[model samples]
Target: MSIRARLLSTIAGQLGNPHGTLGKGVAFMLNRSNHRAIAGAVEATGVTAGATVADIGFGGGAGLSLLLERVGANGSVHGFEISPDMLSRARSRFAGEIGTGRLQLAEGPMTGLPLADNALDAAITVNTMYFVPNLDAACTELVRIVRTGGSLVVGIGDPDAMAKMPFTAYGFTLRPVAEVIAALERAGCTVDHQQLANPPIPHHLLVARPA
Candidate 1:
C-alpha cells in the first residue's frame, strides 16, 4: 500500500479496533467527539431505573456511563465490544460498578452478543456501525437480544458527511440512512429516525422496536 493509504488504514483501523497507546488516544478522542450522539442514543433507549440495558459496541465507553446512570444503582448495564483493548479500559474505568455488579463488559462482536434472547430491556450502539461487515446479521442479533416492547437505538454519522472526510475512505463502510433502517425492519423491528442537531457532521439515530 502507498504510504498515505497505509496511514489512513492505520487511522481507520484504530477507530474500528483500537489498540496500543495510539489506539487508546483515538478512543479518548472518540469519547469526546461522540459525546452528543451518545447522549441522544441513551435517551432514545427509554431506559428506566432497575431495568437491564446493553451498550452494543460501546467504543470508548462514552455511552456506558450514560446507560449506567439511566439504569441507576438498582439497574444493570452490560457492554459488548469487539476490541479487547477498549474492553480492558472499560474494565479498569468502571471497576466500582463492576464490583457492585451494576456494570458488565465483555469482548465480543455485535453479531454474536453472547446474551440470551430477550436479555435486555433496551440497547443502544453509538458510532460503531461502519465497521460492521454484515449489517443484516448484526441487525438480526440486535432484534434477538432486546425484548419485545423494548427499544434499540443505533447512532451513526451521516454517510454524506462521513464521505467528505478523507480518512473514512480507508476502512469505513458508510451506509445510507435508509439502508440501515431497512436492515432493522428486515430484522423484525419497526424503526423511527431522528437527527441530532450537531454541526459539521450530522448524526443519525435509528430507534427500533419489535414490530
Candidate 2:
C-alpha cells in the first residue's frame, strides 16, 4: 500500500479500537476531539438520577464520567468498548466507580451488547456509528436493550463535512442523516429530537424512543 493509504488504514484501525502504545496515543486524541459531541450525546439522552444507562464506545471514559454524574450516585453506568486500550484506560480512570459498583465496563461490540433485554433506561453512542459494520443490527440491539419509553441518543459528525476529511476516504461509512433516522425508525424507535452543535464541523445528535 502507498504510505498515505497505510496511514489512513492505521488511523481507521485505531479509531475502531485502540491497541498498544500507538493506540493509547490515538485514544487520547479521540477523547480530546470528541468531547463536545460526547457532552451533546449525554445531554440528549436526558437521563436522570437513578436511571440505568450505557455509553457505547466510551473512549477513554470521559463521556462515561459525564453520564455517571448525570445519573448521580444512585444510578449506574455501563460502558461498552471494543478497544482494549480504550477499555483499559476507562477502567483505570473510573476505578473508584467500578470498585463502588456504580460503573461497569465491558469489552464488546455494539451489535451484541453484553447487556440484558430491556435492561437500560437509556443509551448513548458518540461518533461511533461509522465504524459499525452492521448498522441495522446495531440499531436492533439498541431497540432490544432499551425498554419502551426509554430513550437513545446517537451523535455523529455531519457526513458532508466528515467526507471532506482526508482520513474518512479510507474505510468510513458516512451515512446521511435521513438514512440514520430511517434506520432507527425501522428498528422500532420513534425519532424525538435532533440537534446540531456549534462550529465548522457541526456534530449531529439524534434522540429517539422505542416506538
What is the C-alpha local distance difference test score of each model? 0.91, 0.86
What number of clashing residue pairs does each candidate have, in the order they appear?
0, 0
- Candidate 1 global Cα RMSD: 1.0
In Å, residue 87's CA in model 2 sits off its true spot by: 1.3
Q: Tens digit of lDDT per residue, candidate 1, span 1-211?
A: 8999899889988988998989789989988888999999999988899999999888899889998999999999999988888999999999999999999889888888889999999999987889999999999999999999999999999999899887899889999999999999999999999999773369999999976
TM-score for every candidate vs. truth?
0.97, 0.95
Q: Taking the tens digit of each residue's C-alpha lDDT, what string does model 2 give over 155-178?
A: 888998999887887778999988
Predicted structure with the largest TM-score when compared to the true one: 1
> What's the lDDT for candidate 2?
0.86
State residue 28's C-alpha deviation in candidate 1, in Å.
Answer: 0.8
